[model samples]
Target chain A: MSQAPSDIDDLIDLMARLPGLGPRSARRAVLRLIQKRGKLMQPLAQAMQGVADTARECLQCGNIGSDDLCKICASEKRANGEICVVEDVADLWAMERAGVFGGRYHVLGGTLSALDAIGPEDLRIPALVRRVTEEGINEVILALNATVDGQTTAHYIADELAERCAVTSLAQGVPIGGELDYLDDGTITAALKARKGF
Target chain B: MSQAPSDIDDLIDLMARLPGLGPRSARRAVLRLIQKRGKLMQPLAQAMQGVADTARECLQCGNIGSDDLCKICASEKRANGEICVVEDVADLWAMERAGVFGGRYHVLGGTLSALDAIGPEDLRIPALVRRVTEEGINEVILALNATVDGQTTAHYIADELAERCAVTSLAQGVPIGGELDYLDDGTITAALKARKGF
Candidate 1:
């Protein structure tokens, strides 16, 4: 027929709903899958099934993993008495890729948003609190984004854990290899304010 | 323990191999799939399985379909003598989306490229030649891309099918609604040279 199969069209529709993909990109992706069914599509399908069958949010930190408790939560090496808190799993993954932190993480699920009506109970704040007390955490590092809602959530967490343990946020400054001219006014101001001895 | 599972890593690596997707995008896509495994990832995996189980290239036209003879090849309505030749299935899908072509299509798979060592034999050119005569084709329309290799392949096919049927190529000019300032010199020149009386 002149039109594509309804299933293929449905697949494209679902693909377009992904984070960075639009309808045009989804169409191209479907075509690529069709063309590479044996080499790529089949394998991709199998992998998705594998992940879908096993992937679950960590019971302790809200991180995605195959088990109820993620690898980080289960590992004794990552138990450094310091927990980096992020607003989402993507940020957790980004921190993991950075390979700097030897400690574990706690995902907040999302930032506090008055407009979206997200409250403390909706996130994993209580679990984080319990973890801080039980694990004898020395510090809670707020790795949330610098947006208003992110900061609001971070400040709320800091307030909640202030009496229990030391709390700190990531430093605001010019990024590594960042050009001064390209930096926004807010970033420049933040960097200037947070400046320390070289 | 901190890193993602090998299966997920494999999925991300395979996703990166798709056209238009890089490593970073693939990572984002994989994470999104993990987060939405029940809603998006499961359905996507099922769709892929459905396509993989049934999808096969049309023996006659090289179009991807769920059947031995694609819907177009099987349909009596699409048996019109006009065969629109394209470089790939993506072009076929694009033309289909436009809903202009009512006849059948011949997907060449790829263009004739000497540097890449791609020849007529590598494409479906021989099959196209056979279809032109056997299917009682009245015209062979070359709708290949405007690129050099596409033109070369079109000309080659035209020369081969010249004695069999009426050979024609798609008209080249400034695209409809395309701004004059944005068009390249070659397109403008061709549009000017091909100008007809009002």
Candidate 2:
């Protein structure tokens, strides 16, 4: 049967493929956009187009920015000789939002996977190794996830940079807002094992 | 603090205002888009722009379309002396997806809300009445929502068009795939009240 004239329906289909939006949610969003076309939808469309046209991956790091080199990589004051290597740009943005880490970041794009045939060459591991020596980094913090692939990638990076610089990792423990009762078995064990002075 | 380089952060903020997305989800979605610029992001941006530029509400009915008259409104085959009334374009799209109603639709944009200062003039109720006589509509089916405001709007329309045409509404019963055990009290009562012969 014929439907909402291809263009609108196509937009709905694409919106449904977004991270948190399902078919029902996407339809509602599209309708909302249509209703507020001048105020919301048009501006959203323009912003997306602007971002799509300008956004690019940093040559030095994998962080997304409007230029060839991201702001973190371009800034001279941020060269604090500490590099936080992350698995995704989302993690880098998360780190930036926390406002704790003062040094620069190196995004690996994704972790190495045997099932997916993604190796060190597939990720930014080689670029990271080169950056360690070129930038005179003192410490390389592996801010990867706790997943099997994430750990494997972290370990691989640590091994690769064993001779060049001191390698470190994020402290494995209960999250800041986590309760011991709700904490997973592994996290509880790690938090207890790594307990510090009161 | 200068968070996320302005442009990216702005996009995230705008995306956060969408129907089903929050700030965190919008951030994740933006990162996802930035990561896959070529495959997903660019296409989505283009689609949004396309729909934004083309989509307009049908002047007669409130249905969204690229032109003044929507396909359903323009089509002669769908002029089956019936006009289905809905609260939003999303509801219209949902009805289209179901492919059950073989007639045109009238989108009221929103239900009557006294608290919000919404009234008959605020909705498409007057336009619906005009269509009943102009289009020789034998039936005006009220496919409004099940909410109080929706029901209030339905009853108001039914009262307005009592002499003009047959005012009908969607049957309230247990949905096709719905289980009685999981049904809410109101739905159960409605289903029992509207029970038909076996």
DockQ for every model, please.
Answer: 0.57, 0.64
DockQ score for model 1: 0.57
In model 2, state the lDDT of residue A157.
92
Report the TM-score of candidate 2, chain A only: 0.96
lDDT of 2 at A3: 63
| Residues B3-93 of candidate 2: C-alpha lDDT, one tens digit per residue | 6768888888889999999998998888888777888888998999899899998998988889999989999999999999999877887
lDDT for A104 in candidate 2 is 92
Please give, for residues B89-138, the per-residue lDDT of candidate 1 as tens digits: 87898899899888999999999999999988899899999999899999
Q: How close is candidate 1 to the true structure, as a TM-score?
A: 0.96
Give candidate 2 regions above 4 Å deviation: none
The Cα RMSD in angstroms, rounded to one decimal, for candidate 1 relative to the true structure is 1.8
Supply candidate 2's per-residue lDDT for B25.
Answer: 92
Q: Write the per-residue lDDT of candidate 1 for residues A1-198, one digit (tens) a residue.
A: 325777787888887877778888888888898888898999988988988898889999998888889989999999999999998887898899889999999999998889999999899899899999999999999999989999999999999999999999999999999999999999999999988999
Model 2 preserves the real interface contacts to a fraction of 0.67
